[model samples]
Each structure stands twice: as C-alpha cells, then as structure tokens.
Target: MRQMSVRRKRRDRPAEDAAGPQVPDLATKGGRLAILDDTEMARIHEVSVTLLAEFGMSDAPPIVAELVCAAGGRMTEEQRLTFPPDLVARALAGLRRDVALCGRLPEHDMALGDGAVHVGSGGAAPMILNIDSDTYRETTLGDLYDAARLVDALPHVQFFARSVVARDMDTDSLLDINTCYAALAGTTKHVFVSAAFPEHVADIAKMCHIVAGGREAFAARPFLSLNINHVAPPMRFSPDAAEVLVAAARAGLPCMVNTFGQMGASSPVTVAGCLAQSNAETLAGMIVAWLANPDVHAVYGARPMVTDLRSGGMAGGSGEQALLTAAATQLARFLGLPNSTIAGATDSKIPDAQAGYEKALSITMAAHAGANLITQTAGMQAGLMGASMEAYVIDNDMLGAIRRSLAPVEISLDTLCATMIAKTIRSDGHFLGHPQTFDRMKSDFLYPGLADRRSIADWQASGARDIRVQAKELATEILAGHFPQTLAPAVDATLRETFDIRLPVARMTKP
Candidate 1:
C-alpha cells in the first residue's frame, strides 16, 4: 500500500501539471516550428529508434556497450538495445538543470539555457588557415593558447570556443579533449568542445576536477561542457558518440547535441524538410540521452549549411541559410530546450561584396529567430575555413549591426511621448541641446565605422573605408589593447604540467 501510494502520487503530478496555455505557434509568426507536425515528429522518432535498434551504431566497442548494460540496459544485436528508464533516471537523478559558464568579471554570471542571447566564436571543421604559422601554417598549441587568451580578453565573448587549431599531441583523438580542457581551465571562461572518444570523457572529468574541484564541485556547480555533433543525414549516432552522451549524463556534464545539416543532401531540399530532419536528429539524441537518464542537461544545437552542388562546396552564410537556422531555433523552443545555431559566417573566402551580404542576412535571421546561443561570431572566411584576425574584426562589427536589426521598433509612449515632442516645438525646431535630445538620441543611435552612412563627398574625403579595411584596423586594435585574465600561480603551474609535452613560447608562433 505504501509503494502503491508513492507511485500514484508520481502519476497524478504529471497530469495535474499538464494544464496550461498551448505553446505559441512559432511558424505563424514566420518561424519554423510549424514545419514539424506532431505526426511527422512521431514518425521520425520511430525511424531513429528503428535505426538504433536494427542497424545500431557502428563500432560502439563491447566495452562501451558493457558499461551501458551494467547500468541496467539490455543489448541484443550490435546496436539493438533498450534502456530501463527507471535506471537511467537514477543516474541523472542527481544532475542539475543550469549550466553557468564563468566570466572574467566576477559579477558576470554567464548562464546557458536562460533564454538570453549569448554569443561566441564558432565555425565548421576542415582547416582553412595554416594555424602553424598563425597565418598559413597548420594549427598548433601556441595558436590555441593565444586564441583562448584573445577570447578571454573580449568582454562580449560569453564562452570560449575551441576557436581553432588541432594542437593535439600526435593528432590522437583522445589528446584533443583534455588539451581543450587545460586551455579553458587556464582562463576564467566557459568552454565548448568536440569530445571524440569515451575514454577521453574521463579527461573531461579531470577538467571538471580542475574547474569544479571534484565530484562535489561538479554536483554543486558544473563548469565542464561538451558539444555532441549528430550525424548529418540518414541520421545515426555512432557507438562511441552514444557512449559520450551517456558519459556526460553519468558525470553530470552539460552537452549540446549539434546538427550540421547540408540541404538537398542530408535533409530534404526544402526548408520544411530541413526542419523535420533537424528536429528528428536533435530529438533522437535527446531521447536516447533522456531515456538513458531523464535528468540530463542537453540543448539542441543546429550547425546546418547548404551544399552547393554546382560548385561542390558548402554555403557558409546566405539567405537560404536562415531557413535552417530560424527553423531550428523554433524546433528547440518547441521541444522546450535551448538552441545553438550560428552567426559570423560567410560563403566567400575573400572579404568582399558577397561575404558582406551573406553574413549580414544569415546572422540577422538567427538573432530574430531567437537562438539562445549562437556561434561562429568571428574568424570565419572562405565558408568557415580561412579564419583570420581580419575576419574576426569584420564579424564583431557585423554582429553589432545585426543585433541592432533585432531591436524592437519604438512604438510606446515612453519612446514617442507627445509631450516631449511638443515641448521643443519651435518654427526652426533647433532644440539640439534639449534634455530629451541628450537622453533619447543616445539610446536609439549607434555610430558605425563599418556600416556606411555618409554623403558622397564626405565618403571620398575619408578615403572611402570599406568593411575589409575597417576589419583589418579593428583586428590590430584588439591584438594591441585587449588583455586576457592573469592566471593564478598554481593554476598556471598546472597548465604547464598538463601541456609540457613540448617547449613553450611566450610570443606569436612561427610556421
């Protein structure tokens, strides 16, 4: 009778809470949620389950499967398995909901999933710049350190992205995980990562140890974060990837399952198809993780790009780009989760006319669509390869402009008070020094060096500075004036010990 009473209370609670206003239709507001009907979502969910059960993920290693099974799952054929929800829930039962990324300023409590727009640097894989030379060389540890420093130095950089560089010892996949952790721990910034192996998950545990101080630190407040990239299309999760998802849940780490879709290839050629596919991918990963542990803290992140068949290239930023971005944002909200799409990307390699339009259009839509966190804010060129300081400068300026686009139009009496308008009513109306002029003009106006708003003669007199020129100049300013946080002596020592595999250089790296 006691056990029956407990279960009854649990069952009754969900029903009691189900009453509420229906979710606002994001699509009717020109958003993407309308693309996914309940029937289609159910169908895709079944497809993902079937794929996991029948095909299973490739090379999940018996060891990986064993840990899951030991945790009360049943594995039949290679990928055919079932997780007892009760057992999964027990593992995540102790998990927390919030993921607070620390900032250099102690007052800046950078929390994720709070519906605020938090921007950072992000990009697609496949090296564009030679990170070795810091100009044209392959990616290296020195560059990674400088990148972290640079990001830490920027006040608006809410979280530190792996930014760029391989920097891993011998290119072993396992080495990448902790290498990033060490870099993040050295700075007072939160990190974003691509954890490739499950064994490396323990390295993330070490990161949590360093940042949070141990299991208690993690349980109390987790600083460790992970990025899980779901397979593009004909979607499936790899066994190792599956293990990492479960690992994060067991360790109480927050993971963002990112979708990198290319239209007409991995998804339907239409925007609606892309939304359904993107939703399917995210829901599948979430379901797998949630079913494995309902207490897991994972967000749906979409990094989808369109494949240009004619050129055999991926379109980094363009008008069609937002179809994936805006729709994905709607999907995330539809499922009651946070969203991660992108900003600061361009399809053009050279910073030119095309790059300007593509980046501006796509980024504006991402903000208006309401992505909680957007990546690729800087250092993108040539469709996400070609990361450059010049590009980073351009992105920051561009982001400033795009954010303004999303600002709500002024319609309130506070904005259009007739009394204030009438107070300065003169025939000449030259109230330049009026009190309202000082108060209100500053709020609505943004002076721009990158955005062109000048007369023809004035423009010519100023040497007609294009965005690229401004970008280069701004990049120089950041390198010269921006200052990253100074590390604690003990933390500095640990950073050295962790990466002392090679000699350290205190200056810019050579190719």
Candidate 2:
C-alpha cells in the first residue's frame, strides 16, 4: 500500500487555523447505542460465515472468479464461489484499521475507524426538486456542481459525494467523467465518485491526476475515492461492478463496498436476517478487494433499507429503516472495520414536517450507533429518487444538532463552573452577563440556520416564512455566491484541453 502523503499546503494552512472554533470532529463516546449484543453479533457473524461457506456468491465476473480461486476459495457445483470461514477471518483481521482519507487540503482530511461521526451527501438521484419552478425536473450536470458548492459551504456537511445524476449527459462514459469533474471542481473536500465501466476508471483517474499536479501526487494522496456497490442482495455480484471494484482496488483508491438490501424484497423480512445477509455480502466485497490487493482500504458499508410491505416500495424514512440501519452499523463496528451507512433519507416528495422528523430520527440513530461515516444525510428525498436543494440546508442544521448530541459533556474543573456559579449568584444575581456564559455561547451551543426560533409575532413581522421557505432562500443565497476556487486556471485549462470537460469554466465561476 502506498502511504498517503500528508504534506500541508503552505497557503491554505493560515486560513484553516483562523477559521475559529473548529467543529470538533467527534465520536459517540458514552451513549453508544448497540442493538446487537455480543451474542447476537456472534450469531450474525456465524450466520454470515455459514452463508459464505455454503450459499456463496454467484454471478462473479471472470476476473473476480479467478481472484477468488487464487485466494483459496472453492467453486461449487452451482458455479458459485464459496469462501471458507478462515478466508473471511483472515481478510477481516488483515484490514488496515486506521484509514485516513486524505483531502486536497489538510483540513478536509478524515481519519476513519475511530467511531468518529462524519455526515455528507450521497448519490444517483434522478430528479431534482427545483425551488424556482416548485416542481421536480431531471437533474443536470450543472445541478450536480451547484449541489456540491452548496454542500461545501455547509459546515456540518463534511464531505461532498455526487448526489444527483447528470441526466443531460448522453453516454455513460461522459456521465462518469463529468460527474468526477463536477465534484472535484465544486469542493476541495475529499470526494466520492463512481464509474460506469471499468475502462472509465483510468479516465477519471487521469482527471484527478491533472488536478493533483501529477500521477504520483494523486496516487500518493488520492483526493477522490470510488463508491462502488459491488453486490446485489443475497450475495450476487454484478460482473461490471465487480470489474470496477477490482480496478479501483488495484488503482490504490479506497472503496466503500456498500450493500443496500431492501427488506422483504432483496433480503429477508426480519432485521437480523437482513443484517446477516448484508453482512455476508459486505464481507464478500471485502474479500474480493483484499484478494485483488491485500492493502486495499475497504469500508464495510451496510445500507440495508426497509420496504413498505403494503405498497412493496422503499420505506427509507420509516422508523424501522432507522432501526435496521443502526443495527447494521453496530454489526460493522463489531467487525472492527471503518463503516458507512445511509441516514436522513426522507420518503416525502417535498421538504416538510415529515421530512424533518424522519431525517432527524434516522440521522440521530445512526450517529448514536457509532457509524464512522454517515452518507445520505443531505439532499435525498422521495426514498432516494429525488434531491432537494432546500432540504440540504435544513439538513445541515439537523446534522449540527446531531453532532452536538454526540459530543461528550465536559465535566472537568474548568468546565464545572462552581466558582462562576457562586460568583454570579453573589454579585450579578444572573449568569447571562457572566464571562463564562458569553465565552461558551458560540463554542458550546449550535444555532440553527434555517429553523425558526422566533416568537410568533416576530416571525410574522419578518416575512411569515416557514422552514422550507427559509431553507430555499438560504440555498439560493448560497448558490448565488459560493463558487469554490479549488481548481487553478492552468489546471482547469489543461483538463479542458485534455478531456471532454463538459462544464463551462464561466458557469462554474458565476452560477
């Protein structure tokens, strides 16, 4: 494995240092919710092991099958590759625990496997909720770039992934290249993108290389990683996706092998059964990546969702979905691997009270469950088919609240405030004017940006705007001004000259 270069940019350091009161990167230290006990975890692991040893994986591509066979897996009569228990154990134990996903700038880097919580946007939504027209429309490449810039300005949104598809792009390869370009051009934060074909991986890599100054620099500290869903439910690998996974692993880019099994459809109805199946599938993905390259930085992503049995449709925002995803996160922790999961995906078509409550419940549950990386926390609505600009801003406030909730309560003598309390009672008769209160106001509490917190009279006097209206206004303001200058003029020109850079430079700078 190539060690990621952690050299800091000289010019960017001062600005990062001066960006006062850093959002403390936190983990759930105390109230770590675990739905699965040791015994249950053991059961899930054993079941997963059994499934791998017997049921095995089907539909592996020729390269994946060869890799599996080379790694001591056996081919069954049904043409499925069966992995022994020891193989799974070895892959699990050999995984690199302290994985640092390096960013273009030092401040954007994320260290995984410490149970630290990080929230970000997620992928592949086909439709966009247009605030201007008050209707849903097909997503475009420009919309993807705008969404990335909006997320970049949000303090609570830690990383920027490709949240919506570029429906305007005609070809898959074009889609692949342009999506990668949009994400990197929109945010300097660590990026996550995908390729349609294994061949397109090199094109995306070349673009990243140009942006990072050279191939060596990009390989040394890959600013972008691939989010490849390697498998369908019940341990079925897509041949094309497998090829992409193999290519990404060999390229030294970190891969999140996300397995999203819909309950009662792709997976078993019971939570434990769904978890066990997803675990087996997740381990299968890890095994393939490990076999391709033992040092591959693989994240055990479990995104098992629920189905509204009555309609037989996805119920991503349901309470059951929250509980199931939280449990899956626990299973990932039990295996001691860096993990990611879906949270805050509302089934509502619009950003409303239902969206608020559903997003809060799921996001809070996943954060409390010790998920290292939480995706789908912004923009996603209508059970992951649609992305909303207004919802992303509102979700930022919710994410801040979640982070505050996960933060440990400092009870040291300095924070104890015994002296300050006594002094305030004795002299001022109130703590509002005290130094400690003033000092801790911004540092301790998180104020919402879009949520209404005014009296009814004040609210009515201002504009009588609701949360969605406020969020839309804020989103518009942010979109109008927040053009990230992550790419230099020379680099941008080189990329446009070298590849089919679809996004015009003028559009990126202005609107």
Candidate 3:
C-alpha cells in the first residue's frame, strides 16, 4: 500500500513540477520563429556577395588558386583571389545540399539537409574538470576515448566528436593518428576528427579503410568525417589547414568548413556586421571546397564566438553568442546547405547554476532556430578549455527537457475521450489506474535518470545527495564498468600493427 501510494503521487504530479532544466524550442513545422525578415536576409546575402567580389580571400595554395581562376575568379598580384558574384552563385547552385553522416551502426545515421535537429558533443579542450579532486588536469588520449564512450551511452547525445586534445602525445603526426584511432575505437557513432598535419590524411584514411573492410566500402559509407578550420576570420585561409581540406576533399571525405568569428575581436562588434562577415567567410570556404572537388560534401560551420571586451576573454556563455549562432542557422537555411554551430558552452569551471542558465539559454535558442547539427552541447566548460564527465550526464537530462518542449501537443476526439473522463470523475474521484495513463506513460513523457525527485522528508531520510553528487557517482560507475568492444581482437591487432596506435588495447576493453 505504501509503494502504491508513492506511485500514485508521482503519477499525479504536474509535468512542470517534475521536469528538470530544458533546452527550449517554440517553432514547429508550418510555423517558424524568424529572427530576420526576408528583406533583412536578402540584405545580408547581398553584402556577403559583394564582400567576396570585392575584398576577396587570401592564402590559397597555388593549385587551389589556379582552380578558382579557371572558374572565373581573379587572382590579384597580392595573391588574394576575388570571386565574382557569378562564381559564388554557381558554387551555391552546385552545392551538395543532401548530406549523410553515417555511423558504424546503421541506426545512428543522420540526414542533415532536411532541417532535422541533431545535438552532440564537440571541442578539443586541453584540460578536464576532475570531479573527485575538484581540480583541473591536462586531458589525455584516454580521456578523449572515455568521453566518446560516455556520450555513446547517452541517449540525447546523438554523435561524438573528439572533445579534448590528447596532450600526452608527443609528435603532431602521432597525435593525429592516435586521435583518429581512439575516437574510432571508443564508439560506433559517427566521429568528427581533426588532423594535425595535412600529410597524415592519407595514412588516416588508410586506417579507416581497413576498419571498413576495404577502400571502396569506406568511401561508400564513411563513418568518420573531417572538421577543417580551413579559413581564419576576416577572409584569410590558414595555409596548412587549407592543404588538409584539399586532401580530404580529394579523398572524397565529408568535411565541415568551421570558421569562428569572435564578435568585437576577430569580427565586427555589431551583430549584423558580424553575421555578414561570417557568412562571407563561410561562403568563401565553400568555394574553395568546391574547387578542390565539385562533388565534395560539406557543412557550413558558422561559429559565433563572443569575447569579454573588459577582460579580453572568450564569452561563449553570453546571450549575444546565442543570438548570433541562432542567426547563423537561419543563414544556412537560406543558402539551402546543411549547417552546424556551437552553443551550451559555459565559462563556469564546474556544473553549477551559472553553467545551467548559460547552457539552457544558448542551447534553447540554437535548437529552437532549427539548427541541423548543434555542436558543443556536452562535456565542455571554461569557454571550451575544460571538460567534465559529470557535466555530460547532467547535460543529457537538460537536453531531454528541451526536446520535450519541441514535441507538438496532440488534441483529437480519440485523445479527448469524453466517456473516459466522465467515468473517471464519477467512479474514482481521480484517475489513478486509468488504462490511458499506463499506455502513454513511456511515449508521452521523458524521465531523467540523474534528476532528483523526492519530498523533503523522503530526501532527508534517504541521505539527501545533491544532483551533482548523484551525477558524479553515476558517471564514475559508467566509466568503470562500460568498456564497449566495438572492434574485434583481430581487427584491433591489425590496426596496431599498421599505424602508431598509442592507446593500449587493454585499456579500451578493461576499466
């Protein structure tokens, strides 16, 4: 009777009372929340087109420059390639809008072009928040692998990118190879990884080929993609990164042209100007990718970063940052290309109230704006410089709440059920054991694993643990016991023999 009473109380509680922190969404199919009107959007587009035709982009490799020139772009004496509006329009028209990010497992595949929202983890932070010690420490290759595995188990985290840099790896080449290996071995989900050197791309591709059984098979369904920070803000290509983009394009690997524009620092302070600059630079990157291969699959990564002018530091947790990223998502839709952007990154050192509000505000804006791929949604802190295992678990719950907000409410004659309502009122005075409640429980509501839900008396009696403490305990248990064996022993042996795979195979299979 006591257990039954408790279950009845839980079922009767209102959704708002039971829900945890939610990422927000207000728009749905047939209705959109637009931040910019059609005219404003057209004005931004015109500015971007003019910027490309006038000032142009710099630091293109000789071959890339020649390709652009052949496509009717003008290479100035100063080596800046000025793209005519016609060239930009041509590239935009020929852009591959439909893109597939495949997972090693079939169920994890996601389509990007249809405005489907997918949230996941991202960043290459150098440090991690050690929950046990409550101190910061350098992130290692093992930390990166563990992050992937943890996110793999999280239902809301649909994909995993290499979230932290492996500082213990000595050489750049070794770092690049081991980063790829660690991420691939940790999860079957599609991985987004960056290479330290352009020359190492072919070798990394070969390793991926072996994992996929053969070269053609890997090309047919790539489980891994490359993130190229191909261009710096203010219309300039980072030469080495551009070379890598070229190589990845030649190999036919999917790429995300990620460019960060820090408002008031690397870009204009005004929001409109910042958006125009970012859009121009992003379009400039697409032109280069098209030049590398006309058929290359790419995503427009418009990262709207913020800086504290008073302190000269990154303010990723600010409202301005959120607005800019949401606006960037709108621009991607306007261009008819798949897009990605960063949000939910907090400057707080730990998962506290500051982290919660900052994360919720930015993440809700991005998700509500219909972003296809919302990155940096988990395991990041201190403005993308630190990551936390416990934070990942907490963020997963938050994402659940946000997703629920997006779900449309249904109302129809069958759902209304006038007869059932009348019978319940007449018979029980409350609908405790209604068949409708039991049938829709799982489908209608999201229950978080880490969120606390107890009365004051029960909580006190049960040794009241804070949500962070509970989350820490849960994260530790998962890390200790969850050793996913995605790769077979023979395949692991072959990879180790072939490349400088630094992460020990034993560590992957054992806690």
lDDT of each: 0.57, 0.84, 0.82
- RMSD to native for every prediction? 12.8, 5.6, 5.1
lDDT of 3 by residue, 1-511 (tens): 0000001123323354333332234232211547887788889989989988888888877766787888999988887888999999999999898888898887778788656777889989999999798899999999999998888777677789889999999999988889999988888888999876689889889888889999899877888888889777778878788888878888878888889988998899988988998998888888888888888888899886888999989999999888888888888888888888898989999999899999988888887777878888988999999999999989988877776666676799869889889998899977658878765653566666567666877677767777798778768877886677778788889999999888987787754
- Per residue, candidate 1 scores C-alpha lDDT tens digits across 91-168 of 334333454555434433455553446667765334544322344445555555555555554434456666665544
Model 2, 33-103: lDDT tens per residue?
88879899999989999999998999988999898888788888899988999899999989878777877
The list of candidate 1 runs beyond 4 A from truth reads: 1-100, 104-108, 113-115, 124-136, 173-178, 185-187, 212-215, 218-221, 230-232, 291-293, 409-411, 425-427, 449-464, 480-483, 498-505, 508-511
Candidate 2 regions exceeding 4 Å error are: 1-31, 418-429
Write down the TM-score of every candidate: 0.77, 0.93, 0.92
Q: Regarding TM-score, does 1 or 2 come out ahead?
A: 2
**Top lDDT prediction, candidate number:** 2
Q: What is the TM-score of candidate 2? A: 0.93
TM-score computed on alpha carbons, candidate 3: 0.92
Q: After superposing candidate 3 on the true structure, give the runs of residues whose Cα lies further than 4 Å from its correct spot.
A: 1-31, 416-433
